[model samples]
Target: MKTIIRNVHKSFGDTKVLHDISLEIEDHEFVVLIGPSGCGKTTLLKIVAGFIPPTDGIVEMDNHVVATSSKSVPPNKRNLSMVFQNFALWPHYDVRKQLLFPLNHHRYISKEIRGSKKERIDEVLEMVGLSEYKHRYPHELSGGQKQRVALARAIAAQPGLMLMDEPLSSLDAHLKQEIRNEIKKISLNVKSSFLYVTHDQSEALSLADKIVVMNKGRIEQVGTPEEIYNFPENPFVARFVGKHNLLNGMWHDDVFVVDGVRWRKDNVSEAFKQKGMIPLRPDELKIVGRGFGNGSGAGLGDGFGGSVEGLPGVINSVYFQGNQYELNVDTKYGELKLFEPLGKWQVGDKVLVGQR
Candidate 1:
């Protein structure tokens, strides 16, 4: 199911939850909606599920208007199933009963259809690795089991599209990773498009084929995980996607100046359309020989001088971060952070700074 959201807008009184959200979800593409808590990722997901009507714009799927001025469809009629974070399930029913319960009440289900439903149930239960626990009651299952049951139920519906709202957030770290793998497996079996909502950047980066980053109820940037992480569109995106050194500088005659230091803009990527603004990644910067790169070769020009080495400043802190050591150095440009290979620097080491 390819979903097209055209100029979608939704509001409650004067508070707008989604504003002019227009997106194209390609067929069978897993798209993840990611942002901070109040960024309206979930609201947009619900509207796509047909739980709420947009105040304006059209929600269309496969060339049919699901939401428009003339008509608005309800949840069940939309043929879309969802897996929620809370694992909504019936406590009174056993696992087998729970998976088959939806089919029994389905208005279109016939006796023969009900008999054939067991094949689908068996397939999904095996997919979730819960085939042996078919008769287990909901209370007997662990958190992960309960979620598996919920996933089994959604898959049994055989929806054309699946919407998951942080389904793994409630699990422990190991369980989370396990379920993430299963999500990929089940999604492949269903061959349905997925609309996933999550605040975890790693989850979005790892799971999504396309990532939609929203901020303040508006779409900020949409791209693949690599695109968003590497080639950010603006200062906001650059800061949001990863760790960045955002320094105030003026571009004068093709050179960028931060504090008293002059750096050639060529070494760093000049991304912003507006000139005189420089944003740098930590890896792009290097600590150089004190008098090497700086134009002035005076005694002061050991090279490019900064707190990392040549310049004198106290080491604020140092911590080991797995593959690298994060160094917080108080520098002339301002407080600067440098990442070096583990065991490279002790608590207090003098170093020079420059960009290559």
Candidate 2:
């Protein structure tokens, strides 16, 4: 493991923030820690970067124990670079000077290493695709470009690991995705492990080799994007990672009973009977004409007196997203929302639904 955390816990005053957090990150892997606000993702990243000491636990990089019960190495000695949400670039320095300021301040580069500093500056500038703007001040660049400069500075040090705390969250969505690709390319080129922290699920899903999903200051689920999305271990994960409809169901001879209706299994039949869930996705539901084309069931089973047909629902709201129209349907399953292509969808239209 390039980076390892064992039994890490943190508390501020009486409130505990991170609880027994432990994870292993392989060298060169871009791993992301994702969760909602106040989940301690940023705190965990800081612990690895040696910005703040862990209350209790072990932090090791390359099998060298950096922080433990008694000893805490300062950030400079740990051989890591960190990029924050706010661009910590110096206002007084131009791009070229800002990138080299770290080595000059830390005095980490010896006379022998100093000979290559100019080429190193050029190398990292090109690495971040900012060779053309090496002379521009940070204030002259756009939000995404400033971040690139910050990234260039971090990479110029050529640390073994990089810690990012929502570095792209400040950019607009389109620019965020573009910079995200640049980040991915940079990680591949450097082959440096990244401990990324973000609340945005899309960012995490697109960048991470493995995602460590956090919730309320604890590790909830850790896996590849597909595993986290498809086989979520519990309700919190099922709802948090993607779109889902939560419905209560009872097991009845391998079938599930919801709202006094039995749902037959689409897969092989088995003997199961207990209280569980039936996750019905919106795309799984179909709209039958006459509000009644029962050609196939919706994504899930459990249609009540409507005879497993599309239940009647009114359009409570309509939102036009770029690629699709998000419809808020007021139905028996509560006010459920679904997305479809933009069209003549009124707020008072009677609609039918089906499942597949």
Task: Give the local distance difference test score of model 2.
Answer: 0.76
What are the per-residue Cα lDDT tens digits for candidate 1 across 145-223? 9999998887676666788999999999899989998988777767678899998877888888899989899998899
lDDT per model, in order? 0.76, 0.76
Q: Write the per-residue lDDT of candidate 2 for residues 1-356, one digit (tens) a residue.
A: 29899999988889999999999999888889999899999888888877788889999988899997578888888868889899898887889998888656543444543667888888888888888988888789888889999888887766778889999978998989899999888888885688899888788888889999899989988999877765566566667776655556576555665555454544321211223765555565554423322233343333343445455567779898899888777766666567777678878776655454
Off by over 4 Å in 1: 104-115, 250-275, 281-315, 329-338, 344-356
Model 2 misplaced stretches (Cα beyond 4 Å): 103-115, 251-257, 260-275, 289-311
- The stretch of ten residues in a row with the least summed lDDT in candidate 1 is 290-299
RMSD in Å for candidate 2, one decimal?
A: 4.5
Worst 10 residues of 2 by lDDT: 266-275
Clashing pairs in 2: 254-272, 286-354, 297-355, 297-356, 298-354, 298-355, 298-356, 299-355, 299-356
Candidate 2: lDDT of 305?
Answer: 32
